[model samples]
Target: MVSQEKKIKVVLAQFPLETHNRGIITVAGMLRDAGMEVVLMGNARAEQIIKVAVQEFADVVGISSYCGGELALGDELLTMAEREGIRDHTVFILGGIFPPKDAPKLKEIGFSATFPPSATREEITSSIKSAIAARSLG
Candidate 1:
């Protein structure tokens, strides 16, 4: 694990779809275990995610979407973040079932990182740490 002088705060947005919660919860556990502060926002809209991120002073907003509408939702999240003026300060991440081919599009929409459902716990945790560190550097 990377040596962190300050704990990174991450807010994981729950997908509106019911079946997707399992992996999101698992990732939340992994993130919390990795020495970061994690808040799992249950069934939240993009607006709520942005609001909560600001309120929590979160460094990253992580979403695990497995319902196949990630592209649209991810775009919406970015738009909301931009509108709320947190687009630069907050790192947005997506994991779970997003097609690999669409990662570039997601990045273009301001996603800091994107992970497939095949990502291991180590990968998810490491990506969050890396994104937070990168954002801090810039």
Candidate 2:
């Protein structure tokens, strides 16, 4: 759990081709209610997401994917973060339409967590909180 002493900041984005913003919006509200700051990037390019994350001084970058291309995009996002020198500073998470079988691949690609379609609000919020706490410590 993230202590109330600091407000965690998260940047939420979806894979470029995905237009479904409802989940992202709902997650944003949940994060805010949990006392974290959130910025939703609504279907953005990897570079754009990274730029905003850096600008916002984000603690976590949560990306939602629904088109089965999360593995490639997740790898690209991690590579970009490494190149930009923010790999260790930011935690990356993937949510929406992910299969249980692909969770390991997502983690190997540097995603901090992967939430399947049925993930509850508590699970998502707790994951974000945990990531933020871990990042702050290390």
Candidate 3:
């Protein structure tokens, strides 16, 4: 039987190195409320994907890029996960100011979902829940 506490490991990747950590924190709180274990990342880092995953024991990673480097950043995260043999276990999500043209490309690169800045909190919450459910089913 599943435990009453549903823990969802999450990583929030915001960009450039400065700005309010509000979005990350907000989503983290919501996930936690939904019984998830959330791990958040700030700014950009080549090594942070693996590092954060290892540190968080993440089931999923939420990468946000307000900066212009989201596509490359998201791919790097997925590549790191694949190399570490963690891909099968981690669901990847990209959020923030993504260029529409690059959206499908990011998905092609392995992001399970993409959310622009306007995406609602409820949408994100539902997405997380759906990912968790899908992971369990698969």
**Deviation in angstroms for 72 in model 3?**
1.6
TM-score pick, better of 1 and 3: 1
Cα deviation of 48 in candidate 1 (Å)?
Answer: 0.9
The order by descending lDDT is 2, 1, 3
- Model 3 per-residue lDDT tens digits across residues 1-138: 579764667876664563656666766777777676666667657466677776778878887666576777667777888888888777888777757989899889988788887787788878877876887788
- lDDT: worst 10-residue window of model 2: 1-10
Best by TM-score: 2
Model 2 TM: 0.91
TM-score of 3: 0.81
What's model 1's lDDT at 90? 89
Per-model TM against the reference = 0.90, 0.91, 0.81
**Local accuracy of candidate 2 as per-residue lDDT tens digits, 10-113:** 89999789867777888888878878888988988999999999888888999888778888888888998998889897889988886778999998888888
Each prediction's Cα lDDT score? 0.83, 0.85, 0.74
